[model samples]
Target: MRHAETVTFGGSALNRAAELRGDKADVLALNENSRSIALWRGKPLICGTNLDQLALLPVSQDLFSEADEPPVPPIFLGQSEDGSALFAHDISAWEPAALDTAAMQQFVDPTQQHHPALPDDHRFVELRGVMAQLSARDAELAATARSIFGWHRSHRFCSNCGAESRMAMSGWQRNCPTCKTSHFPRTDPVVIMLITRGNKVLMGRSPGWPDGMYSLLAGFVEPGETLEAAVRREVYEEAGIRVGAVSYLSSQPWPFPSSLMFGCAGEALNEDITVDPHEIEDALWISREDMLTVFSGQHPTMKPSRKGAIAHFLLRNWLADRLD
Candidate 1:
């Protein structure tokens, strides 16, 4: 795991200026040097001939001040390399006339939305489709925005008292007036294990995943459960394979809806997969030789894991014998 942080969405050491979160006067002073990234219904505004650059507009960009102020206020994402303030705004209020809701819910949204006021090349695209191509900084900013915005959207009503809460601490926290309670954004922990026995690794596909799409078996870490226990329990529960000697690998901030994925390595005691039909549609062990074929697009039935995901990162390292 020497190069653990090298994983996409893992390496950028962005200077998150948490000290300024509660400083109203200093936060106001940021207007002079702040830049904002935008998200429309979770898709970030990106513009590049190759579609690799994230759109970091001036905080006062005219489009942001349109008739409808962004329902979710701008979130302070911390500072950039040059010490300039960085923030993210969710302009989910903008309604696209030809939105493909179905496509949005699929494995990866292929459709891009363009705002009438913005240039045609400047479009909001799904992060999953372009994550591997983005620079480390862009990937971090985009992930941070999508996760916090999704939190605010779903947690508008206070969980403690059922009262509407207000955004606070530069969108890092929510305050409930009636209950006088403060809540912070929560990232659910998920354990995605690289379970292996001999030269083969365990791979599984969910019920509705696209044909031939498979990834390492994963499950949420239950409360009071350690990462090691979660790895063992999940593999057994989903694929009916007992695992032992779990070890940590790299991790990724997966923002499909806000999840911190713990990529771990595990030794499988048995490969007799009695797949829990409710947990996964199928699970099987693929040898190192066959996996390489999948990675090179030569396998006719099993597609490689998505490029930007932690599963792919772990598998790539494992194949290269770098999982030391």
Candidate 2:
């Protein structure tokens, strides 16, 4: 697809400084520089008023050392325009009373309130709620910060010897000091397909989705499987439909704990669905005209997928003949 890179979290050309990952002195210098961004949890600091771009704070800001708390180590995100170093520092250990309730939620707390000691115009907003409003650059930065930090949070223990691991390579890897094993951040592949036959397309909804919410069928790519195989398998397993002639469309970096979604277009060989109750609650085919109604908010039975997700992007482009 010619406009594939225009998808959310797709277009930024971040200059990941791989050479400096192992340089202790240079990494420290960049951390102390005044052009770094301090991210609390996964939310990047943004202007509470504008909320369209990143509000990068200086490294020496009082917020970092508030209550006599030492600033956390910085992870180099790469150089941005003007050749200034762009970094992300995890201030999650701050443990402010305002954020006490956020610890219980599996996702980032969407509370937009300002930190008690921070400036009134600055606050942290969850990326999913405001991603469509952010510029491509800000989206990229937020996605990268979330993915790296999530990996660090889940990979603190070694898989090889069941021993605890230490951070290495400036947040890109973990090393087991006892077993001499090294672990790198992982990105699982998922296949999300637009299966079509004649004028209708296939979609399914998992349990717990909002009322009338439906999206393209998707599942993780299993071990040693090709993208084509995964697409076929997922469709068959979920909706009991066989797919053929799979073709790649576009992709997005889904950073809810780090996964890449490969969007694909598949030709459905059969329309009869026998849904697996274990995988999804329901599956059905919707005509193009009805889909248009759903998108326009005139349909009563279903609603289109949320904006900024690949499913919405694909369906919109398909409707407008922009998928080429």
Clashing pairs counted in every model: 0, 0
**Each candidate's root-mean-square deviation in Å?**
1.4, 2.4
Each model's C-alpha lDDT? 0.90, 0.83
Q: Whose lDDT is greatest here? A: 1
Q: For model 2, give the 10-residue run with minimal summed lDDT.
A: 25-34
lDDT of 2 by residue, 33-149 (tens): 536565677777787567777778776666766623565556677776666677777777666565546543634355764677777787777778788888888888888888988
- Name the lDDT value of residue 255 in candidate 1: 96
Candidate 1 local lDDT, 35-101, one digit each (tens): 9899988999999988898998888876776725544567888887787888888888877788788
Clashing pairs in 1: none
Please identify model 2 stretches exceeding 4 Å from their true place: 24-34, 66-71, 99-109
